[model samples]
Target: MPDLEPHRRELHVHCYRMLASYEEAEDAVQETFLKAWRGWDKFDGDNLFRAWLYRIATNVCLDMIRRTSRQVVTMNSFAEVPWLQPFPDRMLPSDEEPDAVVVNRETIELAFIATMQLLPARQRAAFIARDVLDWSAKETASLLDISVAAANSALQRARATMQEKLPERRSEWTSAELSDEERDLLARFIDAHERCDAAAAIAAAAQDIRVTMPPAPMCFNGLDQLAPLLERAFGPDRDGDWKLVPTVANRMPCSASYLRRPGDTVFRVFKMDVLRVADGKIAEITTFGPSATLKAFDLPQTL
Candidate 1:
């Protein structure tokens, strides 16, 4: 039982990959632990505890996917999966995780997770086992209860899907934890939003920046398209005073934004804006509502 404690974070991450929703993944991990405890007598101790626990976690996620619609997989963009959530870097498995379960940066990146959500469940499982976890074909097959050939076939299909869905800048992906340049840009972005300064906001962004808010079909792809949107957000016609607190999500620099209406005394959380900086400019922004996991961040309810 004590041995299982060390592997909890890794198991949670594996389940997270299987289920795109962060909260759902947590639920699945809890269930996995429960199942493991109830079936302890069935284990002969021949197989490693980590491997056994992962099998339980994977099956739990698979069952959940079987019950729910995989419609998010068929969607063209991540915004279509309104329930998609970020995993805080602080919650990830420690670097001390053994080589077999080491959680690599590229595999845990938000972009990587977003694209993984678009793959079929079995393919996603096969891909993670083979590529991300470095499991052998026989091991993956044994865990999935499939023939080795079938596991290889599924992995090949998953790889093709990944290449198609993932962005082209593989070289730049997860290049650093938080580079100095990105930090400067993030500071400017926070200042711009707090001041509601459209010019400053636009200045911090790339010429063709991309922005998307989940649960909304709104995706502004370029500066020309975003100009009016920025005006509406920051212009005098806006209804509130804004404040932003620096934060991090999905290993990217972000800000938790709050708004105070004309008569209100305290600032209330509005949303979280996660930024992607490239070459000294803001390349993309993904904004998420705070209602789902605001408490996870331990932020104050009022100013």
Candidate 2:
């Protein structure tokens, strides 16, 4: 179990990348542990425990994916189909005491995960394991039960695809340690949302802020566009009572928005929006995990 402790955080992250749902990631970790315990006798001391455990987790994720082809509701999906669920922050790990690993918003940002959804499953695993996690090609191959050459090829393909889709930096700019100003900005953002003040919310965002809603393709950019977006969100059509429940994903602070309904005793969990802030301005927004994942963060569906 001592060996397991070191890898638990990473296992959660890896599984989240594979399954793209925090609750599923937790379940995958538990499932991996059970499998590991049962197969402990067969374990070889020669292998790296982190890498070995990752293999089990990856396989578990793959099996789950095979069973359910998780769909991304994009702008396209929203236009063509019905109801696209927002990934809630309540489903992510708590932001207050995140894992020690470097916490960059992009690491678990819903936008990044949505981009990952575009790749083939094996390519997704290979890219995340080798490039994101810094595993070697040989190690990645061993984990995926593929040849080293195949892993290399998959990694290259994954890199190419990711580069095309996401041009953001590969390294993180922030860690568990956040700047005082950043923290203050997050507090203000939370306050603005709670107050349902569109002007205050817009003021907190950067001029070039961008928002993306996934399993749907609709993306809105710039303050000009975002102002109206917020206006509609907090405008006359609905009650303005909302709450922002703090959570974490990929090491950045996030909020699960809850809407109060008429005659309802508590605020009902609505959507999870993960933010990437740079220089006190919002850079990106990702809505990934469905409401079902909220339980992972100890968030109630209705609060």
Candidate 3:
């Protein structure tokens, strides 16, 4: 029996991109494996195993997708997708070369994932199959059970939609790994929070920064608007102290913040901030979860 474990992570990531929700993607992968197991006798064993598994996974996602609305997501803000979740960079398939790293980074960025919501499910599948996965038109057509011309057409539309929806800063999406500049900025952000210096934290952000805590209707845009919020967050005599551990998510910098109350012995996981850094500034911050279960990220239990 062929072990499906090796393809599990990438399949989860693929499904995450397809479904735009971490939890659902996880289930999709498990289901994918279960289906693969039941159908193992039919597998030719001569064809590419990864491709065969992806075909099944993609079909599963598309079937699930057909049950949902294909509304062209003209989201006024990212807050609309409460289901949107972070993808940890550490979990990405390891690649040593800089160029290869960047290629992986582009497809998994928050912007890319969010914008992809706009396309019809079939078109999204076709586009991702051909462009992101580097599948040939014939391969994509076969995967989606469509003609090659239709697959190419879908791919073109997806590319156009992505180009229109993505921010201008898309060009700066390259960083084989965190550069010195990104680390310094992350350090300042961590220091500001840990030291309870609201001003310093606010200063590290871009003027047109955006903060979104998903599943919350609130999103603060611009420093002038968001400054007061950070002020209270780092306010003096705040109930407890914050400790930040650097982590990476969605191929960008992030921090997992733990809170220790005045008399508490252990620091508990409180929330996470997934950062979108560009031009040496924190352009976007998406924070959610007092996530205690972080074995997925290999994070410490308490500090």
- Indicate which candidate wins on lDDT: 1
Q: Could you tell me the C-alpha RMSD of candidate 2 in Å?
A: 4.7
| Per-model RMSD to reference | 1.9, 4.7, 2.7
Question: What TM-score should be assigned to candidate 3?
Answer: 0.91
Model 1, span 1-70: residue lDDT tens: 5356677777778888887777889899889989998999998688977778888898898888888855
TM-score of each: 0.93, 0.75, 0.91
lDDT of 2 at 262: 63
- How do the residues 176-294 of candidate 3 rate in per-residue lDDT, one tens digit apiece? 48778778999999999999988788789999999888767678899988877776677765768989999888887889999998899988888888888777799889887745227
**What TM-score would candidate 2 get against the native?**
0.75
Candidate 2: which stretches are off by over 4 Å? 1-6, 69-106, 169-172, 215-218, 221-229, 262-266, 287-290, 300-303
lDDT comparison, 2 vs 3, better candidate? 3
Model 2 gets an lDDT of 0.69
> What RMSD does model 3 have?
2.7
Model 3 CA lDDT for position 254: 86
Candidate number of the best TM-score: 1
Which regions in candidate 1 have their CA more than 4 angstroms from the true location? 71-75, 97-100
